[model samples]
Target: GAGVSQTPSNKVTEKGKYVELRCDPISGHTALYWYRQSLGQGPEFLIYFQGTGAADDSGLPNDRFFAVRPEGSVSTLKIQRTERGDSAVYLCASSSFGTGRVRNEQFFGPGTRLTVL
Candidate 1:
């Protein structure tokens, strides 16, 4: 039973570069979510996927942010033209289902810390 995992626990980049963060969810989980947490703030939802389709992507801040979950397993968050304001910790979580009622607890992966300069 592999737990969720994220790559490049830390990242630092120039203000206009592109970056991609990866997440691997636990086996058998059907729902995956991406969120961003600024300093001293709670995680804000960015996108979610159920199976191979995005269920909710309303939280994505702008065109520079995008994510995909293909094969219903691993997912990647891509950011283009990164800005200084985009610096934050990107977190990924997964559960059996997206609904809170069906999946009470979300297993969180150690987040990727992104720093834009």
Candidate 2:
């Protein structure tokens, strides 16, 4: 894909249900990030992956939320026992941290809007 892509642009689920949001980063990017945005707020960092392993996961609210990037190209955000407060837009971004690259240049997906009813 030319840019980051996310699946099922919208998701509606009942409280306590499990939902998985998927992200496909641009090819060859070595870093990926997951963020959540609530109404009128900026995107909140959730997780950051460097290749196949997560480098930073401290931002995840609790054990109920998790993310994985097994092969390093694609990622998934899984929410267990979803709550009404979990209703927000989940965003995925990708960037390269190659040699001599001091900063990350992120390309973002359209995001998956999760509605916990």
Candidate 3:
């Protein structure tokens, strides 16, 4: 089975630009999550989707960040008006279900490194 994957393992951008990061989850996984990790910090949850609906997006910093999961599969994280502070590693993970009751393990992608100048 194919595991989750993310593109452009690395990215460098100027401040105030826009960027889009893509994530492909496991074929049979129904729960997908996006998180950001800053230098020397833990990964912070950004958003999560179950099927085609976003189950939680409260972690998104602001209007500058957005994401979408269509057809209950692949997802994309879009950032607008990027700032130097936005530089970080964006990680994607997936599991069989959203609820943790089943002891599901989250498979993590390599992650996309975004650097905003």
Q: Which is better, 2 or 3, measured by TM-score?
A: 2
Tens digit per residue, CA lDDT, model 3, 46-89: 99898999999999999999999989999999999999999999
Best by lDDT: 2
Candidate 1 residue-wise lDDT, 1-117, digit = tens = 479999989999999999999999999898899999999999999998989899999999999999998899999999999999999999999988545645458899999999999
In TM-score terms, candidate 2 sits at 0.97
lDDT of 2 by residue, 12-95 (tens): 999999999999999999999999999999999999999999999988999999999999889999999999999999999999
Clashes of 1: 0
Tell me model 1's lDDT, rounded to 2 decimals. Answer: 0.93
> In candidate 2, what residue range of length 10 has the lowest lDDT sum?
97-106
- Clashes (N, CA, C under 3 Å) per candidate: 0, 0, 0
Model 2: residues with Cα > 4 Å off, grouped in runs: none
Query: In model 2, what is the error at residue 83, expressed in angstroms?
Result: 0.1
